[model samples]
Target: MYIIFIGTGWFSYVFSLVNLDIYFSKNHWDRYTNFAELSLHILCAIGIYIGRFLRFNSWSLVTQPKHFLSILPGELIGKFPLVVIVLTIAIIAGLYALCKPLVAKSSLYRE
Candidate 1:
């Protein structure tokens, strides 16, 4: 589990770098984005450590209770698209990782 999280975090970091290079070729690199990416990687690493030491499932979707009732509907509406994109990317990446070993084995057998 720790290995998986580290691998995923490293993969995500590399992917983000590639994306930044392609999309921000003409513009200066945004420090906030860099920080956010690094922080996320660290968070995953920490989560893996916690899971290993505390025997918790690190991949579980743990949500925090928020005061959504007090928040304006407009803010939630604006965040919907961003949430969708994040979830989509996460799902795609997870699927890719899950399939990678089988794909590699199949290619090796074919060759």
Candidate 2:
């Protein structure tokens, strides 16, 4: 959790230092940065989903908020199919993995 916060903080700090909008507009280095940023955001989303399901509470909120905003601009690139599919898969997998620990001791049938 602490590690996730540190990583997210570092990623945001580095992202703030660059002119990503302008870079994309000029077609200079945007492809690499966009892919990297997308990958990172997807991972963060998965992390947040897992944390929430497991009630981890640490660094989940910090990382989760960015997921909504990041996906908006992502649509502009017309790189939809792959990124969306990957993110969906990641989220589903995270939820499934987290659910086991969370639901393992819970009763499925009401007695």
Candidate 3:
């Protein structure tokens, strides 16, 4: 877990900036990208909750597809999953909002 979610999340933002630099120009800073990012983060939080609590890693989907899918529905629709996913998204978003300006001002960032 420590190795997986080590950073406070500046790393992911920086990686996205690099991806934009590669695909589009460095000047491409779309506001809608934030919405897309938030949506992705929410989904990822749900997945993380599933993986952590249910012990269903990525390989479980491929190796044990039937069991994984069968159990997924039950695991997903409940108060625990909802609370965990929401809290994870909230923390990451809050940290992003608090630290983004600092990230943007760093030498690693570009206009």
Stretches of model 2 off by over 4 angstroms after superposition: 1-27, 59-111
lDDT of 3 by residue, 1-111 (tens): 676686735577646644543444335756556766687678778878978999889899899999999999998898988899899989867876676666667687665
Q: lDDT tens string, model 1, 1-111?
A: 999997766655555544544454446655455554445544554444435433446334343214322332333354553455455456545654565445435533222
Estimate the TM-score for candidate 2. 0.29
lDDT comparing candidate 3 with the true structure: 0.73
Overall lDDT per candidate, in order of appearance = 0.48, 0.50, 0.73
Please give the lDDT score for candidate 2.
Answer: 0.50
Clashes of 2: 0
The order by descending TM-score is 3, 1, 2
Better of 2 and 3 by TM-score: 3
Give the TM-score comparing model 3 with the true structure, all chains together: 0.73
